[model samples]
Target chain A: MKYKDYYKILGVEKSASADDIKKAYRKLAHKYHPDVSKEADAEAQFKEVGEAYETLKNPEKRAAYDQLGSFQPGQDFRPPPDWGGQFGAGQHFSEDADFSDFLHGLMGGRFSQKHGGATMPIPGEDFEVAARITLEQAASGSEIEIKLSVHEPDAQGFPRRVPCSIKARIAKGATQGQRLRVPGKGGKGLNGGRDGDLYLKIELAPHRLYRVQDHDLYVDLPLAPWEAVLGATVEVPTLSGRVRLKVPPGTQAGQQLRLAHRGLPKPHKGEGDLYAIAQIVVPAKVSERESALYQQLAEGSDFKPRSHFDLEVADEH
Target chain B: MNIEISEAVWLDRAGVISMSELAQLSGLSEAILLQLIEYEVLPPAASAAGGPTFTGDCLVTARMACRLQSDFELDAAGLALVLSLLDRIRGLEAEVRGLQAQAPRRPHKA
Candidate 1:
């Protein structure tokens, strides 16, 4: 096994006082705490620091570890062959601390205890994973499956993997970033303790046709120029199905029309409204007859499209 | 392959859980949890004749406090401050997201 210099990990000297060690550990732990730190590997770094402090904080463990003299971090080293039976079965570190094999070897298998008689209870650590779903799935309830790699302690305290697949129910109107908790589905507890719960974070995949803002859904509604000028009833697509929406007379581009109760489902309430924004489209190509009709209308009409530009210039001047 | 259907109970959906269940799920002692509640690190949602009840969101908060206590040796006051600050940050982030969602589309840069 590679030697791990606990003093080096804590950035302290081997002869440093216990107070100095404690101060350094506190500073590093606070800096690297996963919830507070924005570092990508803050969690891993925090665990490493915790492991280092676990050994250095205790005098007995420190003395035992210091016996392997002058060994550097990452150097090949092994504990003395006669060192296996000295430690007792009592656990010192926290339940979530999955100590390295080096520490386990030093303690003659730390998790190994006398299971034939009464055993100490240690609850397993909770685990989390994201479950991604489509927008339609978020609107309507669906079932999802996720795989978790659980660590099971053997009869001798050696760790082994047990792959578990869980099928979960997603309730209707579940929004992005919502967490669904599953009870007693995490890592196995030690000595018959209860298993930890699993937290599934919901992630809504982006949709091409719609944009979601909370429960409200937005879609671009393209219409012909004549249809925008004259009132028309048009069909719009919603999560549930298609519904006919009325376009009021003289509807302008960029104007949004609300279709009540046609958006995503809300918890303990009716569905939210969908906003369909108007986009007027003009024909790029015209036949001779259509061109003549358009020319006649353009000559006969008194409408001025640039009337707003004159007002804007006068305001600026 | 056999498909195992999990009889999952969504904590957020349930909204409230008993104190004993919270303790069991968070792996914290009842006394320490009571201390946390007393310090306002986590507030209970309701109270019964037996004991106080907490929201499912408190499960995450209690578990986090437990870990921070173990890793950094923080006291109840420290846990309370940290948890409150974290909650504020989450609120701000959600507000920012809502505002962004409401904003109109910007013109494409040339």
Candidate 2:
């Protein structure tokens, strides 16, 4: 097992007073708390700090840890041969104790008793995983299989992470950032305690054809310049399927053509709208006859796109 | 490989869980949960036939409160203050995410 320097973890001196140790722990805990901290590994850092404080805060555990002598963190070492004999050797640690093997060897049965009596019922630890699904899956419910590495104790009562697989059905109308609770799927409870729950945070993967804003869906509807000037019926894609939409004459660029009740499904309500934003596309290449026709139209028509610019310049002057 | 079909509930739905269920799921005592409710750290979504019911988000908050209470030996009032601050931070983070999503994406300069 690797040696861990508890004092170094808490950033306190080996001879620091209990109050100083506590103050250090509080500061670190505040900085590294998973919910509060934005650090990428805040949860892991918080657990390490908590484990260090768990041992150092107690008088007996600290004394016992001190007797083992200091070593470099992560240096491979085992407890002294007589170490178990000195501490409570015959006592068994709790199956749910998640402390490091080093602390488990040093503290013995004292830690288990402090948490709750060995026979006392302790609930299992909850697990959370962020699951990403496609927009179609959110529109229509889908089944997903999730593999989780759950921390469990071996037959000898040593902590180990065992791989667990679970299959869950995400209900339809589930929105992005929704939390789905799977009961009795988390860590196993101890001493007849209730099993913990698993929380799956639903994330919608970006779609190639659509952009989602809440339940609304947006898609770029490319139209020919003539089609924008003349009315036409165009086929639009919805989550369910394709539908024919009427594009009115004189449709401008960036205009949203709303198709009601065609977007994502909302729980306990009607579906959201699908908006097709108009984009007029001009032909990049044309035949000689088409170029001549365009030139004739350009000379015949007195359309001025820069009229707004001229007006703004005149106003400024 | 064998597949185990699990029972799941959406947390955002109103009145999904009771106070007792929340207490059990959070590994906190009912009395402690009551104290948190009294301090408004966890406000129930609605009152059910049996008692007040909470949304799924309360479970996360309740678990956090349990840990903070044990780790820092904080009272209900202190936990309330900390929880309120955490809620504000989450709100600000969500607002920032929304704003970023609305902002136009610009190509990075090499």
Candidate 3:
């Protein structure tokens, strides 16, 4: 699998202000809205753009993505074995509408709440629902089928998706609380009025993979003390998958390794990134040989580990 | 098992009608609009300064006209007359709404 960049899809710079990113997405959404668009791929492109905007617009998810690298769209993406730690029984996004397998493979299958058209239009009859998908889908894009008891406009010229299925292409880089509109799939009209569309409220689920912060992805990359101390090529996990990481020599714990174009793929153009924080783990106790080695290291090195420490004088003047 | 498939005209995203400012999107064509004007059914595109230039509200008008032409078998002249009547009726309805609002508010099925 490959990670996709959310920023590129929305057409913004890595350091683009939040406001700029949002503006870009809104412009694209309006342009690609299926109801008005006549292009062959308008609906798909609109959804893709929306998803990309969703990811980059959020500060938390964006940050988590930044850890992997500069996100690219459609690049081979795969998360490491320990990507999400454990994808247990928990639904994050709603995929009430039908989505694509590409999205499923990329996102790891998140489902969203499906909604339908409004009826009983004396007034105030509105329909609303939600969808839950994984962070992967937000980054890589997917297709989903939202099954709702909708009234599709038939040849007779009435409202219709009734008992209809709307196929939604969940864009890569979609963020939590993002709302997408499935035109003509909204609430029923009043007195033969136009049907209100389906509004999708996006919600993200928590995973053990990494903590998201804006466009950067942060994951605790476990490293042996020796590996951290001596530069080594470590197999680090990203949202896309695992890649050989270069740990600089004498690397300290909590140091982050940045790999470009390795984060969430963008819907269209820009990329999000990922970060790997080197976390060193040690056993509670070491064998005698290990202890002797440490002792030798202590004897040979004059470097004071706590030299920066300051102690209060016994008698303060 | 082998299967038989049929082909049909697929209209998906529609198309883009880029204007100097906002793009007018639609699946219909300019010829349709010309026919509409020739019949004198609806108003022409008025590009008020700092407003949508080419065709803004024309999308809805065009859709209605297209539906009338394709489904009702209404020729361009017939559509123009019918749509003109419909627009007049709509105006009357709006005036009625205004008058009703002055009288009282009631929960009525439109």
iRMS for all predictions?
4.8, 5.4, 22.7
> After superposing candidate 3, which stretches have Cα over 4 Å from the reference?
A1-126, A147-166, A311-317, B1-110
Candidates in order, TM-scores: namely 0.74, 0.80, 0.42
**Residue A250, candidate 1: alpha-carbon lDDT:** 98
* Reference-based lDDT, residue A194, model 2: 74
Better candidate number, 1 or 3, judged by lDDT? 1
Locate the minimum summed-lDDT window of 10 residues in model 3 chain A.
A108-117
lDDT string, candidate 2, A1-317, tens digits: 67789999999999999999999999998899876788889988998998899898999889878877878997766555565445544434444343375365446532333233477766787888888899999898889889987766555554555678999998777767777789888877777877888888888998877777667777778888778989789999899899999999999877889999998897556787888888787777888998999899899989887899999999999
CAPRI class assigned to model 1: acceptable
| Poorest 10 consecutive residues by lDDT, candidate 1 chain A | A90-99
What is the DockQ score of candidate 3, to 2 decimals? 0.01
Can you give the DockQ of every candidate in the order shown?
0.41, 0.41, 0.01
- TM-score of chain B, per candidate? 0.84, 0.82, 0.59
Residue pair clashes in candidate 2? none
Of models 2 and 3, which has the larger lDDT? 2
Model 1: runs farther than 4 Å from truth? A1-32, A62-85, A88-110, A114-118, A220-235, A247-256, A267-270, A277-317, B35-41, B105-110
